[model samples]
Structure formats: structure tokens, C-alpha cells
Target: METIGWGILATGKIAHTFARDLALVPGARLAAVGSRRAESAQAFAQEYGAAAAHGSYEELVSDPAVDVVYIATPHALHLDNARLAFEAGKHVLCEKPLTLDVAAAEEMVRLAHRHDRFLMEAMWTACHPVIRALQKRIRSGEFGTPRHLHAELGFRVDAPPEGRMFNPELGASALLDMGIYPLIVAHLLLGPAERLTATGDLSERGIDLDIAITGRYPGGALATMTASMTSYSSRACEIATDRGRIRFDDFHHPDRAVFTPYRPGRGSWAVEPGEPVVVDGGEPVLGRGYGNEIAEVGRCLREGLRESPLVPHEQTLALLRQMDDLRAQVGVSFPV
Candidate 1:
């Protein structure tokens, strides 16, 4: 297709953010929007300039104008939503974590292959310019051998018990919503986890509210990560290498990654740091970085690719598997 058409499958906050960034991407347009409520669909369509408002998901997926569907529904509904889109012959960009567990994610992938359509988990952090650049540099040994990484993302969630953040039925957990970032960053920078240990506090509803993860990655690199729903965090990330230290004040939507080299000392490595190098994301970070993912989706569709190289299916599944283990260790389980 010359121009990519997008169908947003929900009218939630994330959907709105995606819609806003969709406008910034070239060769992409919001063709339609769907919601359980007609009015919600209509409002989202109007706000985003979608050509059609679908009261039901079936209508949105079936709309000829919609070449691909962006599933922004809750974690629990992703399987069904993606199934609807794939069955209707539309490619999918489903939000992360792909599903509550690996089996469900595998099933989603299976459905996509069965339907012969494109499928990708919306792990936009993997597509962020800064993260991508950092990954390349780390792999290239630009900053020497990575030794340790620390990333934390959290916030004081004040939503009601029935809301998506606290609702077990919606597959709500701090691990899914917040911890995924730290895990993904560690995977991207330090390579896959060879060993992992987790500890956390769960809500009365059996959902994780606070979680801490420590892992040993490739090259013997170690990482410590945490996610919380009852406090505030800097949302920062730091990676220490033999040659230097890389830091991002806000790794989630970082503008740049700063690397500071260690200075030589009389008898030991300098306790003080040397000159710093600021690594730009290499591409313009569009609208909180969601635009980058949209652009990625468009590029993949235009190239007739089945999945994004940045957010590959295997990577998504691997992270979900890690989460399953972590949740099990922490005594957190969601109803099936």
C-alpha cells in the first residue's frame, strides 16, 4: 500500500497517545476507531480525524479503510481483539506485555501465523531512538564491556480498584505495566538473563504492587530492577561498563544517553569521572517516542514484513516468560 491506514481498537488513554503520535508519522493515517460504546468511538474518531467510527470491534476490523489494527485494550482483552483483527485480514500492533503469560502470547502468535498476517507487540521502548542507539553502541564495545545495569520505573497510582491499574480481571500488575521496561532494557543492553531472582508485595486482589528483580545477563553483567504502584520513581536507568558509565535520567522517553568515562588514577581507576559523551537517539523522537513505533509499523507494512526487527515476537515471548517466573516467585496470580 502507498499509504498505511490504521484502526485504533480502543479509546483509552494509551489509544489517545497513539493517535496523537500517528498524526506525526508520514504515510500513516487513522482510518477508523472502535469502542464498545458508539459515543466513545465517535469522540475518538473526531479527535483523531479518523474517517470512520466503529461502535464495535468487528466493524472496525472489517472496515476496508483499515489496513492494520492497533489494539489498545486492556491486557486481558488482547488475545480476543487481535484474533478479531487477524481473522478480518488486518495486521496487528498489540500493546505489551503481549499477554499475561507465555501460553497466551504463543497462542496469539499462532493465530497471526494461521491467518497469514503481520503481528507485533507494542514494546515501544525497543523502538525508542535512544535505546536503539545505546544497544548498538553497547554491542559494538563503544563503551567497553558492560558490567552492571539498574533501571526503575514506578508511580503512585491512585486509580480505583475497578480501574485497569488495580483490577485483576484486566490483568493488572506492576510487573506488566512497569517492570517490563526494566527487563527489556536489561535484555537489550546486557543480553538475555541467564539467572533471575524476584521478590515483591502483592495486593489483596492477588496482583503485584511492588516488585524487585535481580538478574545475571550475558558477559556476567548484573542488573537490578524495580517496579512499584504505590510510590514515585525517577524512572532512571544506568549501565556501568569497564570503560565508562551510561546514564539516562528518564530512560522511558529519554532524549539522550550520557556516557562518562573513568579517568586514570595514580594506582587505581579514578574515583572521579572523565569527559562525558552524549549519545543522541540518532532519529528524532516523535511525541513521547510513540511516533517511532508507528513509523516502524508503517515501514514494516510497506516492506511486507511479518514482524518488527526491533520488537520481535521472540523477544516479547521471552520477556513474558520471565514475568511468569517472577510472578510465580512473588505469589501473584491472576484468574484465568
Candidate 2:
């Protein structure tokens, strides 16, 4: 197909953002939107200028006009939603944390490979230009060997018990909702961890309210990450090397990063620290940066690629395993 047609599976906030950004892509068109309620579907389709409004996911996937489907449902529904799209012979772009557990994630990947369909986890941060540039620099060995990485993301959420944030039935937990960002940063910069230990505070509902994770990489690198829903944090990420350190203030949707050089020891003859060099990620395009990942999906479709190299299936599975391990350590469980 010359122009890829996109269908959104849900009418939630994240779905709306993806719909807006899909419009900004050059070779993508939002052809349809699906929701449980017909009225909700119609309203979303009208607002996004989509041609079709599907009252159910079945109708959306059966619509021949839609070449690909973007699953924007909650964490618990991702696996089944993706299965529906894959069974209907459409490519899928599922939201982050792919699934609640490694087994589910593996099943999704296996299904994709079995059907020869395109599938990717929508880890939008990995698609950002700033992250790409940082990876390039790290590979180039410009900052020496990375020794330690630290990242934190937290915000106060005062939602009701039934809300997605605090609802155990909806797969609510700080580690899955917010901690994934910091973990993604660590994995991107330091690869997979050889050892991991975690501790967290749990809510009355048996959900994690705050979590702290420490990992040791195979190359002797260390990473510390934290996420919380009970307090506020800087939401920053720092990667320290022998030569210098890179800092991203808003690591999830980073638009700027600062690199600072540091020297060890208090010797008078040691060279003084140099001024930090700033790198800007240009400007935000189409709804807080979802456009980049949308464009990536279009590119992969056009090239007949089934999986994105940036957010590969293996990486997605590995991250899911890490999260599963963390939850096991913290004694947090969600209704499967």
C-alpha cells in the first residue's frame, strides 16, 4: 500500500494522543477508531477525522481499509488486544510493558512470528532523537566506559480506587506504569542486567506504590532506578562514565541533554572540569512526541519489516522478564 491506513483500538487518553500524532506522519492516515461503546467510537472518529468508527475491536480489525492497528488499551488488555489484531491479519503496535508478564510477551512475539506480521512495543522514548544520539555516542566510546546509571520517575496521583493508577484489577502499579521508563533507560545504556534486587512499598490493594531497583550489568556497570505514585520526583536520568556524565532532565520525552566532564581525586594538578555541552532534540511534533514512533511504524511497514530494530522483539521480552522478576521480589501480583 502506498499510504498505510491505521486503526486505533481504544478511545482512552493515550489512544487520542496516538491518533493526533498519526495524522502528522507523512505516509500514515487514521482510517478508523474502535471503542466498546458505539457513541464513544463515533465521537472519537469524528474528532480525529477518521472515516470509520467501529463499535467493537472485531469490526475495526475486519475493516479492510486498516493496514495496521495501534493497541492503546490498559496494561492488562494488551495481550488479548494484540492477539485480536494479529489474528485478523493486521500489523500491531502495542503500548509499553507489552504485557504484564514475560510469558504473555513471549506468546505475543511467537504469534507475530507465526503469522509473519509486524509487531512492536510502543516504547516511544527509545524512538526519540535524543536517545538515538546518546546511544550513538556511547557506541562511539566518546565518554569512556559507562560505570553507573541513575534514573527516577514519579508523580502524585490522587485518583479514585477504580481508576487505572490505583486499581489492581486494571494492573495498577508504580513499577509497570512509571518504573518502566527508568528501566528502559538503564537497559538502553547498559544492556541487560546480570543481577537485580528490588524493594517497594505496597498499597492496601496489594499494589506497589513506590519501587526501588538496583541492577548489576555483565560489564561491571551498575544502575539504580526508582518510581513512585505517592510522591514527586525530578524524572531525570544520568549516565556516568569515567570521562563525563550525560543528564536528561525529562528523560521520558527528553528535548535536551547536558554532558559534563568530571575528574576524580583532589590533587591540585588535576585538570579542572569543563563546561557542559548541551544537545537539543529540536522541537516537539504532534502531541508530546508520539509522532516519532508513528513514523517509525510507517517506515517499517513500507520496508516490509515485521519488527523495529530500535525496539526489537528480543528487547521487549527481556524487559518484560526484568519486570516479572522485580514483581516477584516485591510480592506484587495482579489478577491475570
Candidate 3:
């Protein structure tokens, strides 16, 4: 396979991580780095060993050497950055939350389809080996008929009001930034929610500080998820089924999970538990598993795939719509 040239559209922390991970991917090269400031872009390029550095996103997207552009900009800029890349005939692997809202995400998807360019929301968790193993177990019906799920992700960030976590202008909200993790795991395990209810607390800046969501799936499975930036949480997920329960600690980037089977004649609330089987994610590729998604993008590009089957366009839209609905319920709206 020919090497794929990657242009990073931002010099943010996420961009640094992606560039670091790109080094681990076979046939993937960090061909360019772009930022609003020339100094920032040049520094990132020097650090990442990119062949080119552009002072502006337009310059980066227009680089003929860049086969794909990774949009690691803030959520607010995703739509424009992605559009610019697609217009330049570059495939896109955008940071999750895709855009500030469902409408923006839809527009990006439409443009990608119309342009015949590959586009995928960089939900790296969807490409992890651990997640694949869990999917396999679910498909094999090892845990019969999932009934309930509980997941949470939270951390305390004592940033000032102007910080990204509390700034509505920057598309800051616990639900969109941190809460998406729990939502992603729920979607992966239980599929889209048929109905959902949400409650949240907001900052003085009108940003969501915390959010709690409960969803009911068409299959009768129930999910409870919570995300917060003002508190600390275990960041875990548990899926209960007729046969047993699967527990994943730090579910966002899980390294292992445990399945505890239920014995016959034991009620769902019974204390008698069977032996627990530990499933490890095994050794990840370099860059702590981010390479998985990078590899997936490379494979899709090589195969002429416009979107990954694992993280399809429909899934991204569905998730975005869910977030939109949740935000509406909580009365949270971004400037975008």
C-alpha cells in the first residue's frame, strides 16, 4: 500500500496525540501541520517531523501532498475545518462530537458524500481491540439479552470561567466533551435509544457542568449515563444480562473487562455469584491504542471506503442527534 499523507489541522493537545500515534501506523505519515499562527504550526511540524507546515488551515488543506486531513480543532470549528478539507479533496478523520450540533454534523456528512471523500468521526474507542472483543461476545450471545447498562465519565477540572471547559463560546459542555464517552459505549452495546430523559446542572456561563441521561432501547434494554467536569467518578460501565454481567473500568479506553456468569435458580438480585473471567485487551499498538483508528482509516482509504463500517455515518448522526436532544432537555445551547 502507498503511504497516506496526513495533515493535522490544529496544534491542540489532541493534534499532538494524533501526530504521535500516526508514527505508529504503517504507511501513515504526518505530512503537514497547520495552525492559525505560523509559529505554532512550524513548532508542531518540527516536533512531529512533518514535511510541511502551513500558517492557516486553508494552506494545509490545499497541500497536494496531504491525502487526508485530521481535524483536531475544537468542536466549534469541526464543520468548517472538515468542509475545507473535503473541498480540497482530502479525506477527513474528525475529532468526536463531529460538530457543535446535529445539523452541522449532517452538513459535513452530506458534503463528504457529495464530494466522494472519506469521512469518519474519530471515535477511537470504536476501533479498540477491547471493544471488538466485547462486540464478539455480544454477537455470540454469551450474555443473553442485555437488560441494563450503567456508565459514567467524570473528572474535576478547576479551570477559570474562560477555560475551554466552561466557555460556551468554545463549545464547552460536559455532555459534548466528556459525556460522549459514556454515550458512545451505550450506543455500542445497546444501539440507539428509543427514548431518553436528561437532567443537568449548568455553569454561570451557560455551559453544562454535569449531565445525567437515562435511555430506553427498542429492545427493552435500559441505560443510565452520567458525565461531569466538576466532580470525579470511577469512569466505568456495566452491562447486565440474563446470563451475567460485563464490567469495564475506565470504559472509554478500557484495557480489560470482567464477565461474571449467573447460576441457575439464582435471582437477578441474588448474592451468589459465579467465577469472574477476566478479558484483557492484550498488547495495543504504539501510542496507547490510538493507532487502531489510524490503521482503520488507512485501511478504508486503501479499500476506497468512504466511511468505516465500525463507525458508520449513520452512527455518528444518531449519536449527534442524541446529544442534541439531551442538550434541548437540559436547555443548553452553544453559540454555533
Candidate 4:
């Protein structure tokens, strides 16, 4: 095919979103889908109008028509799935958190580089234009050299003991799942953190119910983020800068956010709509998942870029390293 063709390796909810979004981009094709079960793969393909489906991951990766693969398998399989795609000479966009831990993420990045393939941790929030706008405004001194951030991503999960989040074999934890979002967003706005203080409550099976973390980055910038699988949060992330604070209504994966200028010694702030960057307001793309990341993978394939600047290998690794440390502090090690 002349256009970039995508192969989705997994039939999870996020995978469906990715596929649905992939269709939105011009010249992008939902070429195929792969699932552990043939029925699941076929069902996903039919739902997304994809051309083909494969029962096994290897089959999907090696499909000649597929220019790239989006791996939305669980965290534990991220490394393996991405490596298989790279070996098959296809670009890969793996869902976050990129792997179970930093070591796995590092190995995956190395594998991609060694094999000369594009690889990216599909942190969809990073590619979001609204997020980009926020980052730019913050960096441009519009937010006055952002000094602090308050963020959280959490929702109660009352799954059975054998559920994915509670399954030790799945490398499950709130820090690695819900936690990565706030950490990554902190990195985006405040850059790498220099100090981290974290605490959490773990389940009997070792899953985290919640984690509250504080990071102090270079230049005294600080970010406090909390994530949990046992509670709800109204605000996800916020930034307080030297000048003013930026507010994200739904901070982690935001659709619409606003910037308020902080005037020194002034009781109130100014919320200047930063051009109101808005995409088509409609039902979300659901067949595969967030289409922007899938489209980005396709764009990289077409242009031959080895990775997404938005979700770089180092960033994923660093964030995971921090998360690993936090989990360690809380004594929440996965069985693996």
C-alpha cells in the first residue's frame, strides 16, 4: 500500500481506541489486528473495518502489508511484543507504561535501535495538541518558569483477586499504570526530577491502592502527584508558575485546559484562553484506541524516524526508574 498501514497487536480496549483513531488520519490504514485468540482478533478487525486478523502475535508482526505495529498488550508483554515487531522490520508504538520496569523498557529500546526500527511508548497524552500547547505556554514563560504542579489520576478498581490489576503475574500496580501518567506529565512540564519522595498502600497480592509522590526537579521546581485504583479524583494535573498557574480540567489526558496568569501580589488570576485548541467534538474513536498515537506511528514509518520525539525512550526509562524506586519504597514488588 502507498499509505502507511498499521497492525494492531492486541485486542484490548486501548487497542480498539488506537485502531479507531488510526482510521481518522488520512492515508493511514488499519491493515490488521492480532490477538491471543483468533476470535478476538477477528472480532476486533470486523469492528474496526481492518482488512485482516491474526490469532498469534508473530503472524501479525510478520504480515508484509503492515508497515507498523501498535502493541497494546499488557505491561508485562510490552517488551516482547515490541521486540517481535522490530525483528519483523516494522515500526512499533507500545502502550504505556512501556514495560513492567525500567530494565525491560531499556532492553526494548536497545532492541529497537539494534534492529534499526522505530519504537515509541504510546503516551497518548504527550502527542495531544492541547498538551503541547500547555507545554509551550509554560516553557515560553507564560506560566513564569513553572515552579510547582499538583496532579493525580485515580479510579477505584474493585476487580476480582484474579483480575489484571491484582494479578501478580501481570506486573500490576497503580504506580506503573495510573502513576506513570502524572509522572510523565511532570517530566513534560518540569523536566527530569532530581528528588522523589513517595508513599503508598499495597494490596495483599501486592498491588498499590494509591500512591502519593512528590518530586523536586532542577531549579527547585516541584511536582506533587497522586494516583490510585481505589478512589476518584476531580482534578488530574495543575501547574503553578512564577507568573500564574495553568489548570487542566482533566489533567492527565486532557481535551480542554486553560492557562491563568499569576500576577504577583494580586488576589486573583487571569485565565487567558490559549487559542482554545479544539478538535472535532464527537464520540471517541473506539475500534483500536487513541488514533493520534497510531497516526504518529504511521507518520514515523512514512518518514523513517526511529522514535517519537513526544514519547522518547529515555523519558519512559527515567519515569519507570522513578516508579520502580517508589514501589520499592512501599515494598510493592511484583512476583516477577
Using Cα atoms with residue i matched to residue i, what is each candidate's TM-score against the true structure?
0.97, 0.94, 0.94, 0.91
- Candidate 1 residue 132 Cα shift, in angstroms, is 0.9
In order, what lDDT does every prediction score? 0.92, 0.89, 0.89, 0.79
Clashing pairs in 2: none
Top-TM-score structure, candidate number: 1
Question: Candidate 2's residue-wise lDDT over 74-105, tens digit each?
Answer: 99999899989999999999988798899989
True lDDT of residue 40, candidate 2: 99
Candidate 1 Cα RMSD (Å): 1.8
Q: List model 1 lDDT by residue over 191-252, tens digit each.
A: 88998899999899999999999999987899999999999999999998898799999998
Top-scoring candidate (lDDT): 1
lDDT value for candidate 2? 0.89
Better of 1 and 3 by TM-score: 1
Query: Residue 121 in model 1: shift from native, Å?
Result: 0.4
Question: What total of clashing residue pairs does each candidate reach?
Answer: 0, 0, 0, 15
Residue 133 in model 4: lDDT: 69
